[model samples]
Target: MKKKIRIKKALQYFGVPAVIDSIKAQYFGGSELFSIKLDYLEHPLSLRLLGSDVPTFKKIFIEQEYDFHTNIPPKVIVDAGANVGFTSVYLANKFPECKIISIEPEAENFEVLKLNTKPYKNIVAIQAALWNENKKINLVDPGKGSWGFTAEDSDDNDADLIDAVTVDYLLEHYKLGHIDILKIDIEGSEKEVFDDTSKWLSNVNSIVIELHERMKQGCNRSFYTGTPGFNVEWQKGENVFIARDEEVMSPR
Candidate 1:
């Protein structure tokens, strides 16, 4: 497994040929806060000025073969945990007329997220964490990059408090009666969001989530149990694609 991951990493870095991307890393090709341009994409995208995030980019941009296909391109897409807005940008370009709502909690990442999606008028950016409520939550760093900032209830005094809202709140405020595509990568908080998802699960047409049971043990169960209405459309590595059998099964 380690060997395969390393091989894929090599392919994404040197093999994919971002030969023109400017780099100012701590060490050349070493993972310590390097800026990279994904000009190779339909819309050019760049990483945030944060340390050690290249691998996360590589995993989504290179290794994760998540083809955003639908019978008709998604009309409403919600990107939870939208770090740096790469996925949101891709969605916007792929679905030009679709409305995109992106949420990110980390200050540095949210700044870059806005910058990357600035050209797209269809995208709406939010700088709040999505929890099960509309309250302040402390973020815990899982340490490689801003990708692992989990919204958890805590009181360490030193930790910073940021605003959080439920998925239901997002749907209600956005007036999204039915979400065409709901992409969630909120680290390990799938447990919290899916705990009482009776209100929103039925309205979601398709869902692509990166479950963190490997990092937080009961996440897979939480997601699966909560989403009893959707079928496991497909899965690769840690990510799972789910949708209603009758409505969204045709898209895949």
Candidate 2:
């Protein structure tokens, strides 16, 4: 009789995942969008910032591929929180025909994002924040505690009111009736942004979101997921993707 393979023994003998990851990082010099071999999984695995610090673009590319396999080519992609153009670059490379609007409000991150995406022609870098309406919002980066721009830290001094616009307003102002993919990573502001999503939910085909479980405060939006017409696949980590089976939702 063949002996059962003990999980811990097997992991130790074959080298644990963390050890393997360390070796890969040292050998590969951080990861871009590449088919990386990991453990027993034959499928390619994506490691965040494999070779660079905060590889935002690479992370987005890998995250989107988790469950999003659309045959219909994307026409436009809206990146609500383009940190350093990591995802923007990946999306542009994947869908060369698609136009990307990368929104970043953090001054420090925006500088990097702009430089990183400068080589791409399809990406439009907008240093702003999306809200329920068009207005100025206090931009705050609570250091390592948060991952988005917000008004929470506004002291009414040294605060910049970024241009805030709803998805509907953007579609109408830009004369775009449809958005192929809407990727939002606004830290915890997704609740407010989603509150107005109903206006354009029917126009969007696919949505990728990173829900901040801790950001539930001050948010009044509630999502009805896994319904008959709505299809949702929730990734363990804060990321989630939602799509419509019948028709895509378009704002404006």
Candidate 3:
């Protein structure tokens, strides 16, 4: 399964034409419900990212409307595990006034993330892992199995590691008083990020997270309750929406 997924990803990364060719070649007569094809370019500003072109788990999150319970239109957004920075760019464009801070740990991915957000001045891209503590730790590369980063002791593939910081530390360091919307999609490390972020949750107005139920390091499903904001719906998708309860805005 891992090999097959990797091959598919490789073909998709190649281009839209390669993706179409691979699908037709493999399935022949079968029909796929939907698919996204990214058109990567050599130029930084020319790079385009959207649900129509990029096959990512955050597509659903982008389509959904926030349940607004306050007058605040999300002046600040924290995007953890920004991947290629599509979501950060999207939010920045959607809310021009909002300040977006995207956190990504992988070296290669972080470069792409920075490039993708280069056109937007409101977005700040950081190349580091968000952890429970403000210290550096070794990371595990699961080849093609999962893009999720974990502690080195969790896996023994490569001996590479990087520095990390806590959410509270980031808020304090950046002088961000309250977060309007916080989106976390750090593969499987959502548990630790949330567990160690109790000090900052009270000020967060809205949250959308991608929960991994089946993880070797125990899923972080338990930490969802401590948050004070609104209790939104949950579906079997990449990310789930949890809005603030004070002002419930019906989905348009």
Candidate 4:
């Protein structure tokens, strides 16, 4: 049943020929990267894995995880923890005029992200981890594959150091007056980012996040506490959509 559903979705997103090619790449093909061509996109999306990226790709392209309805076209979109630039690419295609900043910590994932987003001029890929402060941190991979990397403060010399930046820093560095859409999937780092939202929370108009309460406690508490005036717009799959007051969704 699950297999049938997945195939159905794949056909809907990638069409018949791409789906068959994907299956062939999964079993028969070896080592070579698989490419997916969508009618809506100008270039084919390159997938590094036959298995690891399928679920993420399905969630973004097929399931439309980040599909939020807004009357206002966002001017600035920030994709924190943008794994291989899937959501960034999706949004870039959806809103070609909007400026998108795609942030990723993992080295390999950042490389693939650059490749995937190369066709879109509106997307600016930044290789860094989103954190509460602008500092160096260690990325901990808890065996949850590529999308599950988390950031933690560490002084150990052997630790994998990754550059971490705050939302405020990004705003200042890029000269963005405000963020219209802030999409966060930074593993368990939401607790830290939302713990004290007084600095940057007010500047954001909307948020779409996947809470990682199972990975780190107090995530829900911090998020809700930080976004007091925001209204819960909707939830699809694991993502929660919130907007800054009900008027944000109202047609201008």
Candidate 5:
């Protein structure tokens, strides 16, 4: 069943035209990546196919995550696991006044994230894993670049250690009194973050997360259980929306 779903997802990722373009790009070998300039936001973005062309505009702009109808624009937005910085760019355009900090852990993905968000001065791209602790940890590279990076407890000693930061650290480091919107899609490390939302949840008004229980067991449970005061709604897709005030949802 999982194999079948993966096949369908791969088909969707390629569709018809992308497959042809991907093949051409492979042979030409001029640039490994492609640039996309969005007309709506006037934001330039770069895309690499290793699950990094990850469509997020639909959820950000179309779905309206940080948008508050009450005319209270978001002050600060934190984007965890901001793959390639598309989502951070989207948030930057959507809330021009808001300061966005885009965090991506993978080396290759972090490089791309920096490039894509560089044009926007408001977006600060950081290379750090959002985990429970501040210590370094082993990161499992599933080869799917943006989509499948996972954190594992290993004692290999020679294993590459990635710098990590906790939610508590972010609040203190950024001097963020309160996070207007916190979008977490940290692949599977969310289990570690949600392990304790007590220190962070009070300061966050809106929360948009993409849970991956299949990737890390109890991801859904951890988020659901940890955030007791917030209103949690599981959307149609792999994402979930939780808020302290009025619930946010897709208008369409």
Candidate 6:
């Protein structure tokens, strides 16, 4: 059954004790933080079920959603919408030499992200939403918990505004010559970021994005339109792995 398969995976990743603790946290615990130490990681990962972070943790650690392989080691990586720094921590361990820029917009999620990625010297956490332009935007939570915050352009006087920056701004601010791997999971806002890719698409060699067509219409259309020379290499879970046709594939 599916439940048995999930238990097997949990045992494979976290062992028997951690699995029991995870179940206790999910069912009995409320809003209390817990830490689990992974054998491959230098530090323990913090999580809470109240914010819906445990599901995200399971997707990344147990399901191995970002386990796609590459031919070369990446020099630079951009983890947009890095909720609680799970993916960033995974990548930082996978590619210790690569410089990682982890961006998260939600205040609470950003705090956890900073905590999770603080031990990794290669990761630089930034609090901002990645958009097509540099400006202020509103964070909208569609009742999908902490990992589901989406950014939208708003001119309302009392809108929950946050700093939004384009991919071009990231490159300039960090002085990154090119992005070897660009991982995007910005809820439904991929529609806005992919709407115009002229400024930073060419500088990126590969992309792994989760298109949110169900949340926002035209997300797939905009993403496909923006990526012209890139070819779909594979799809793992909800993410689509894309790489430039001419460039050598990077990021293991």
Clashing pairs in 6: none
Better of 4 and 5 by lDDT: 4
Over 151-181, each residue of candidate 2 has an lDDT whose tens digit, in order, gives 4423244445677778887688777688888
> Which candidate model has the greater lDDT, 2 or 3?
3
What TM-score against the true fold does each predicted structure earn?
0.81, 0.67, 0.70, 0.86, 0.81, 0.86
**For model 4, what is the C-alpha lDDT against the true structure?**
0.82
Work out candidate 2's RMSD over C-alphas. 9.7
Model 2 stretches with alpha carbons more than 4 Å out: 1-52, 55-58, 61-67, 152-159, 218-221, 225-229, 246-252
Model 2: which ten-residue window has the lowest total lDDT? 1-10
How far does residue 9 in candidate 2 sit from its true spot (Å)? Answer: 26
Superior candidate under TM-score, 1 versus 5: 5
**lDDT value, residue 65 of candidate 6:** 90
Report, for all candidates in order, the number of backbone clashes: 2, 15, 5, 0, 0, 0
lDDT of 1: 0.73
Candidate ranking under lDDT, highest first, comes to 6, 4, 1, 5, 3, 2
Measured over all alpha carbons after superposition, the RMSD of each candidate to the real structure, in angstroms, is 4.9, 9.7, 7.2, 4.0, 4.5, 4.4
lDDT of each: 0.73, 0.60, 0.61, 0.82, 0.71, 0.84
Q: Write the per-residue lDDT of candidate 4 for residues 161-250, one digit (tens) a residue.
A: 989999999998999989998999999899999988888887899888999999999999988888877865677899888887655542
Q: After superposition, how far is residue 242 of candidate 4 from its true place, in Å?
A: 0.5
| Candidate 3 lDDT by residue in tens digits, 1-252 | 212323444344455664565456445644322334333322232122221223453352334332233454677889987776767766775677889989888886677677678878888898878777877767666653225565432223344667677778778888888787788776667667765456887778777777776654555555564564566645435557677663522233
lDDT of 5 at 31: 47
Model 6: runs farther than 4 Å from truth? 1-31, 157-159, 245-247, 250-252
lDDT of 3: 0.61
RMSD of 3: 7.2
Worst 10 residues of 5 by lDDT: 1-10
